[model samples]
Target: MPTFTTRKNKIVLTDYNYRRDIENRLFMAELSILEVDVLQEIINGSLKTTLTTLADNLEIAPSKLRPILDKLAKSGLFQIQGDGVLVDKEMRKYYEAHIIKFDDDFRPDMEYLQGLLSKAPIHALPSWYAIPRSSDNIFNSIIEKFLFTPKIYERYLQDLVFDNPIISSIAKQVFAAPDYKISASALIEKFGLTREQFEEYMLFLEFSLVCCLRYVKTNDVWEEVVTPFHEWHEFLLFVQNTHPVAIQDVTPITAVYEKEFGFLNELNAFVKKLLKKGVSFTNAPKDLLEVALLLEIAKQEKQKIVASVYTEDWLKKTRADQAIILYRQSLNRLIANEQFTSFSEKDLREVEKSLKNFAHGKWVYFEDYIKGCLAAVGSVLPTSLVNRGKRWKYSTPNYNEDEREFIKLITCEYLMQAGMVATGYHQDKLCLCLTPFGRLSLG
Candidate 1:
């Protein structure tokens, strides 16, 4: 029978043998590190520990440690009682009833026994642990070395690490096209990953490439850097030679690239421009607004707009002015729509007056005109109705003018609801426009 000597100098049947002697067997063959530690403590009569104590000892959060204990209990290794865990009474009785003996010099060889313990297959381990720790610490050492000595890494791994081909292909296509840029958020939407997972995968891929293939980090986000095809080819050859198993199963790498390339390609161009312009120049809100307006203009022109005019002088002279133009253009498009033609002359005049007021900085009157027009179009309810103004003297209650105006601009949903304006959708938001009665009054 297999046996283990406890730290207290008592010989006991191993969990496997004790379980077998009691005519019970584990359904699964492996336990996590925490489980192994907890089992050893239980056997040694030192199992009294709270969740916090376990977390402190294990260097993990109490919430994280609790799940590990729950898993052990669920797997029939122990019975959790109140705040403590106990050995399975039957298994313990079996151990006591059929005690095993070993040589006087027989000491528990933890390292050897742990090695003997059948662990989950490499593929079955969590990706965080499995991908880094497998193949006799190959990936782990590489990641450590790359993070610590980035300069040495650049010299050694640059030729071997390849640029992500998927992103490069997409970027080439985007750059080749006129007046178009990919949307980073749209690409993320396609993959449906949480922000954290996307970030983790990006970091993992970048570090892996840098250490194994000798890539350099040239951009704030590593994904934004341009990698040459020749470098990538050499990197693939290196991967094939150094880690045959990883090369054999390239599905993980491929999946990550396929999922993220659409967004990364667009972001790469944006980052390149931002870096060239310098941080102080690009950080201004006006500069950003100008970029947005230029992008919009480029969309209209069907041409790409380079950041050549992103200078301080350009921002001081033209950024805000261009934004105003774009805003005016947006309003003009709304007024020209077929639905607005049915508006009465008085209502059209009100809209024009509001547009002029907005141009001259009478922000409050401009807001009212925009809201009244939206109400006339049935896109949003009048601020009064949604705000329950009937009970109060003022049409807009509690909300300041700025707050009401902000809501109207953001939730204008003409493209939503099949291009029709609807009020119920926006709920209590001053987002709803006028009913038919209100529209007829404008006429």
Candidate 2:
């Protein structure tokens, strides 16, 4: 939720509540830009308006608008009476009480959209792999999570691969020409779109991170320039280049983008191989272990850096240029020595033995995987207080959750991100397995 206010005849959403991940995921998925605009128009109107009136306000033809209205109605967004639509009682009450205004348009400011999705810049790295492997799946599970079968344009350039002819044409034109630029008016005329439709569509495309639009005010007329991604690497490069301004209160780390892209190329091949075999990870790890280890090193070396506070010093120096240089040296030394840097030889052997016990290319519960790993090290689970049933709970003081978290930190958080493991769901339970890369690396 965000605090809604009217400033100079424009609606501004400020003070965004970040603890709305589940709600944000659903809201982004369930409501399209056009749907939100339609709902906004209805709420601003009498809350009961004819399709013709609503369509006219939204600048959409009644025939083209009918399906959107019907879909919203089915979802209990509003009620339909023949040609008229009425806002649902509960939904209207909530909107009026908390969000909507009678006079101002409910269109959210683009700044708020960018701020709300600041994490997008971070996701661009993994997306370098995802857009090529399966652009439809949410990238790295770090971007907007599109659970199950996601809709087109749910996240990360999906709209480029949209089934709609107009979008397909747009994608082809953009990709066919590097740094394609088109004026708003010209694009609208070329695509035969109303002004409102063009705004909604472009806004959706921008939100999907497919392109970036820079608008200028000239002689009281706003003109927009669309710069679409010309290559796969351009997406991350754009994010990296613009993150300083786009993401507030966060310093953009100078990552080795060329090196990262090289790794992504390898990861993309592995994912494509899996997809070709009709196997894709439903869940993949987030966070980079190298970054984590470097951060730890930075913290240990923070005495030399000057800052007002410990957090400030830590954040400033963790991914700083000097730190990156130091980390590279440290990493190379470890690699040259062939040392087990992160774990003991015993622990690594135990994990390998545990993984070897299970057959690959099959789904098993994540808990089962954790239990097998713990068992390989001769760990025992206490019996339950009550008699065992079809689904029995372990006794208190059991190390299941603790061990699961630690193991996932190594396997899911680190190994999976390294393309050594892939996780998915089987019967609604999280599961994991070794990838072809993982088997070869281990062997």
Candidate 3:
């Protein structure tokens, strides 16, 4: 069992015996091999198939398959009609909205996706934990690091030290003792370091997104205390118990997102004002709309579009001026999309840095500049064929479809949850636009 102090609720990591609640256990319940194959057959058959056909496909007799089908129906995974089985309607609709049909070529990949989903962790917060204040925590800092600098975070995860030996040693000590709050003076004495040296080390730990400092009143003096958050379950427990903003309310990501870009509140207000008129989308899917918005935000950052341009007075400009801005932005959007789609998982920071360089409206050819930047940043991509000037040229591009999906997942879905973007519809398609809170956060 993990140890934690009653007063500070600080965690002491000895063994990871984090147990899931009954709800989560049931939610992640593993299916038997027969059950999985049966579901696959149903999905492959467009969510419905006659009893004889399903049994034939499985190389099992109708008599043997009847029991499985009956079991699935009882579990709400299937509905048995007179002669056929149909997947639950709600489940069918969800799969239809999210996936293409499992043709022969992609059926195996579809199975792989199913396996991945079954193993995916289900995250939930208890009702008492308010989500709005969630950003003001160390977990949020770690999440931001993952979002903005995934490659670096991946490297850090390979070694829990995060390349800083001092902090790692300190964290180890904190973890070594359970239910005891180690004081600042004691750590300084134990490590045989000066006060300034200890403070600097603590600062590095906090800044590097590892452990953090809290205050605990010991005897007559208020002393500094440190604790380890070695696992996600422990962090979730901390968030539930901790009220970080006991006095002033602030979220860490809000400040981090606004770094080097400044217009979040203004952009948020503009979006709200537009939504007051009521908007609807006819043909846009939620995911597609989010991607569209991310692209638009990137373009806006690259062009350094003033808040004024997004206002109604933009229509007051001359046709030529309007046409020029429209044409350039439209053309830039295509260029940006191409560059984004071409990005490797390791090159996300490269893309983000390139956009930030243009935040002052300093635009350049997308491919040429990215190739140069990739080279400068020491990307592992082969650079021999980079400057041939041919369109759609990639220099030894290593494509990982999973990485691309993860990037899109965090930027699109997680961004909305962070209050950086708002969703609606425009011109009969789904639209996502930045709120003022997200304005300066794009690049």
Candidate 4:
């Protein structure tokens, strides 16, 4: 229940109370830039407005906008009233604040994305996943608890996958295929699904990580592929008290998610601790593992953070608590950038400048390369591979410039090759700890 307030004509969100996993799910589902923009509009526009008026503001057909609007409304940001829609005053305020902070137009114009999504298939990445979606499901750790064991797929089968007979039949048909592909004709039989349900199932699977349209040329269209990213199986090992594998051992999948999404691990581990207590459903029990991940982050950096503050619900995080997270994320970057080089105010300013010039998702090349560097260094962000020294056709839109490549090589590959981050064993896993140089960079 984050509270919203207006500040300088923008809404501010406080007390981010919703579960992080929920937000993670939404982001991973590739919430189009347009949808986020629509949220911005609701917050900044008149509280009471008709669908047509909103549509007109975005220059889209009201008919085309309705479904998107309706879906977002389910998030409790708004409600469909008699003739028009009315938004929750507070959530509207919250969104306004969020948009103002980013100060970037990440508007997902749906018309462009829908077309682009079809064209984009998962390509061979730089031996690591760029970033996995929905950190909660990364290892399927918490999600697995909700699902039954022995047959992992069986858990979600009844509750989600086959809950709708149509999707159930679709699942069965698709699973029967020798490969992840199933002909479209196979799913269209007998179900009589409304166009809406079909679309819903498709979207759900994308989020669920059950499957996605990776595009098969012989099929000649984007077709659902089963169980996104098979290498994610390595993450399942975390459930056991097994030998520690170095962070580098995890990959083909990007390391960013393991670090970025580590926040949720605390919550998920806490829930399991409660479940073990066998407490009544209504009674919320103590969470033993809460804050464990943050503490781990602190320990790795030779830093310390208040346990209670970082563990508090995101909505309840103090400004200081929030700053700690941001500072740590930045610290990791600074360490990687200069390899233990001390950063002056000017140095920090340059980092900020780069971030401002290349907002998240804008500089895909730099972002990916940086992520690769963080993964290589084993920073707050995680990498999938443990060994360095191999280059693949690391595919991304060409942002090629001689300087950029040199920087990427120096920042990511050379850091490890030169031993800027000390590497060794920790609990049977690969450990990449910050070196003396890295420690100095924090100052």
Q: Give candidate 1 regions above 4 Å deviation.
A: 1-28, 45-47, 75-77, 88-443
Best by TM-score: 3
Worst 10 residues of 1 by lDDT: 1-10
List the candidates' TM-scores in order. 0.17, 0.23, 0.25, 0.22
Candidate 1 lDDT, 76-119, residue by residue in tens? 54676666665675554433321211112322222212222222
Q: Output the TM-score of candidate 4.
A: 0.22
Better of 1 and 3 by TM-score: 3
> Alpha-carbon error at 374 in model 2, in Å?
35
Please give the range of 10 consecutive residues that has the lowest summed lDDT in model 3. Answer: 5-14
Tens digits of lDDT, candidate 3, 1-443 = 22221212112111122222122222212335565466567755756678999988899999988887776565455688978777776665444322232222222121222232232222221111122434554333334442123244334433343344555667666645444236666787888877666665654454333454444434534345665322222422332333111112222112323321122333344333433432243333344333334424211333232232244454344433432343233323434554345444344443333333333322123222222232212225532212233211223323254444433333333443444434333233332334444445544
lDDT of 1 at 31: 38
lDDT of 2 by residue, 149-232 (tens): 112222323423443457455544544443355565667678998655554555444444454444434454434545552222
CA lDDT of each candidate?
A: 0.32, 0.43, 0.41, 0.39
Q: Tens digits of per-residue lDDT for model 4 on 330-438?
A: 4454455554353333433333223221222211233433332212121121223221232111111222343344334433332322222233333343333333432
Relative to the unseen true structure, what is the C-alpha lDDT of residue 243 in candidate 4, on a scale of 0 to 100? Answer: 23
Return the clash pairs for model 2, or none. none
- Superposed by TM-score, candidate 4 places the C-alpha of residue 432 at a distance from the truth, in angstroms, of 33
Clashing pairs in 3: 264-436, 264-437, 265-436, 267-435, 267-436, 268-435, 268-436
